[model samples]
Target chain A: MRVLGVDPGLTRCGVGVVEGVAGRPLTMIGVGVVRTPADADLGHRLVAVEQGIEQWLDEHRPEFVAVERVFSQHNVRTVMGTAQASAVAMLCAARRGIPVALHTPSEVKAAVTGSGRADKAQVGAMVTRLLRLSAPPKPADAADALALAICHIWRAPAQNRLQQAVALHTAKAPKGRTA
Target chain B: MRVLGVDPGLTRCGVGVVEGVAGRPLTMIGVGVVRTPADADLGHRLVAVEQGIEQWLDEHRPEFVAVERVFSQHNVRTVMGTAQASAVAMLCAARRGIPVALHTPSEVKAAVTGSGRADKAQVGAMVTRLLRLSAPPKPADAADALALAICHIWRAPAQNRLQQAVALHTAKAPKGRTA
Candidate 1:
């Protein structure tokens, strides 16, 4: 499975793309940010986010998306910004018929570091070790995003089973047969 | 200014268009829902959301938008659907260079009812009274969405100030200056 993970922000949104086979390790396709200066207008920032996602999608072509869920922030305006960034990434995935899964920070951290309360440093260390990378990913958020995509793969078995069950039920249903 | 408010959903999205002058009340130009089946594939649902937004934008030719931001939900799949719906609305607004504002449930409730903790019935009643509706608007979500657009107008002074501040700062930047 190929997954694109995103950490949405107004100033510098983080993104990581990874591809994994059933038994093999995930290979990092790309990792980067879509940045706008803090002084930029909200419209410009939103535009940057849209362009950034589109550019990455065009290059990497990830089949699955993993994004950070909306968490509360103290600043109403900041929360609004994060919400918009999340919306942009989600739309980018939806446009291409890609399936998306939203993961909480704790969920991703735990999956990566075996602890819900693991700090970014710890998560980064674990990701570097797990992926056996030559170097740890930069900008903390990007590393976190990569870890999140790996987590979603570990957690997505239920989705496949449910889809399988539903398919079987539909296939065996009484379509046009009299009782 | 003409502002469009969209309350997005996979099966049915509520859309309302209102035109408000600088000093006058927001007057409704149109409101309705664009629905897709629950059993339809994810692609179909996204298409419905996009088509619905495109149709409304074409008809109303709105200058701005206020969208109800999707918060964390109990259901993972439902949250994914809502996020997709929201992305389509944002894309529609962004494509036209229309400024989009994100509002939380509490913010909309407080703006319409003067209480962040107001219940749905209280909110619906207050919106009807505030808008001078002959009767309560159907599908509380739709009315709440209309209330959000009106709220943006009521709160425009601050919005305009921010935009103006951004413009002034950008204008003063040293761009393409002779070295």
Candidate 2:
């Protein structure tokens, strides 16, 4: 499966594409950041983000788009920008019927580093090793983007199994029972 | 001047259009709410908002788009949705090259009711009076949207004069001298 991961931010939105399935070696297709000027008006900044994400979608056309889920508990100012950027990324994907998945920061870290509380350097190092790159993607955000894609690629299989189990159980059970 | 006002929300997005200048009586061209199912996914919700805002833009052809400024200090979950919805509204306007303006709730209230802390009912009443409508717009969000457009219409003149004053002073000052 091919997936695009987005670490959303207004100033620097990180995007990366990974191709592979669970229990197999994954390949990094592309990774980069979309930067918007700080001085630009909010409307124009959002437009820039939309354009950048659209360009990525056109170039890669991944089957799924994974966005870093935003939590309002973070720095109040930064969280708003993150939410806005993520919305743009999700919108771009959904407009084209690409499935969008959301992964929390801890989920991405835990998937790659075996610990939910892993530091940035540790996450970066793990991404470099997993992707077999000469070095970690620059700007930390890029590394996080790769981590998100890797996490989604690894977790999806297990999730699908759970979903299938539930479906089968539901079908075999007595009728007229509500969830 | 024609202005479209947007009060952004995930479940119910309010939109209104007003036409007139700062001093003269304003006309309420249109007012309504765009609703998305609460169970809908985030990306689809945003797409719905974009389509709704775009339809308003096409029908009204407003010169300016005024959206309520989202603050992260509000209900955490609700605030994130508001920020996301507002981003989509701004994106729709900016993509079309229409000037976008953000008005705070306090500013909208102050512009209409002469008090920044005015209650929603007061603001709604004033909007009705200003627009010479027989009744206030239904759903507080709709009223708030009209208030936003009215606020933008009334404030733009003063803001313009302030800009002109600063430009004039700069032109009269010595050149090549840093402040």
Candidate 3:
């Protein structure tokens, strides 16, 4: 399965695409961020965002989208922008018949770092180590994107074979069966 | 000044780069989306996004970045993913020394449509018409990015002499500074 992980923002939004299941990993496929100018009106910025997303969709055509859920921000404007960007992502996926899932920051951190409160540098270092790469991904956002992807992998049904096995067992046992 | 607009997402984050002096017409430099798979793990997806965005930054190198503000989503999972994408954008710009700006959807819509309640198609069509393009940018996300750039332009101090004048009048000449 292919999943796209997103770190949404108004000026810059991070994105990552992964395809693979446990015990095997798929290609990085691609990664990048969309940019918008300051001093330009908000309308123009939104236009830039729409354009970037469309091109990415044409390129990747992911089956499921995973996004990070926002909790709270000290800055209201920032929070609001984050929310709208989030909506934009959801909008893109829904329009394409793709399923989108969100994970909280804590959840992603825990999934990737084994601790929900891991800091950016820690997570970045861990991501590099986990991926077994020569160097850490440049820009903290990229590392966060990787964390999001890894979180989805751990959260996805495939990772929890116990549930699947139980489901299969119940299915084969016929109606009203419990495993 | 040139501005880059972004619409954040997991699979496809839309982007538009426009250049213009304050009060002058904004010109499109490039517009496209960065994409990744939906089912792949979060880590892989983020890598894809980073790579794609890096390419865009290297290719265009806008002075500023603008993005849609993220809003709340009832679905916990969806919101989380969107937030992550937003952060990715911020990191991208920060790394490139480009200042990033965030704007709400309403702000973007109002800048173009004069109404915060404008729908996607309305905003899209208006953006196309404003840019005097042959067709509306494909995909609503791209159109939104264009709208964001337009919004920044509309709100720019150099672009709106009247607003600047009002501000000057309101400031009461600022402590004997030269006129």
Q: What does candidate 3's lDDT look like per residue over B65-111, in tens digits? A: 67777766435556555555665666566444455677888999998
For model 3 the local lDDT of residue A33 reads 75
C-alpha RMSD in Å of predicted model 2 compared with the true structure: 8.4
Question: Which should have the higher DockQ, number 1 or number 2?
Answer: 2
Q: Write the per-residue lDDT of candidate 2 for residues A39-133, one digit (tens) a residue.
A: 66677778888888888888898878899999999998798889999999988887776767899999999999999999999999999999999
- For model 2, name the residue pairs that clash: none
Docking class of 3: incorrect
Model 2: residues >4 Å from true position, as ranges?
A158-179, B158-179
- Chain A (candidate 3) TM-score to true chain A: 0.81
Badly placed stretches (over 4 Å) of model 3 are: A1-179, B73-75, B158-179
lDDT of each: 0.71, 0.83, 0.66
TM-scores of chain B alone in all candidate structures, in the order given: 0.83, 0.88, 0.82
The CAPRI class of candidate 2 is incorrect
Docking outcome class, model 1: incorrect
Rate residue B23 of model 2 by lDDT: 79
Q: What local lDDT score does residue B66 receive in model 3, on the 0 to 100 scale? A: 79
Q: What is the TM-score of each candidate against the true structure?
A: 0.69, 0.89, 0.49
**RMSD for each of the candidates:** 7.6, 8.4, 15.4
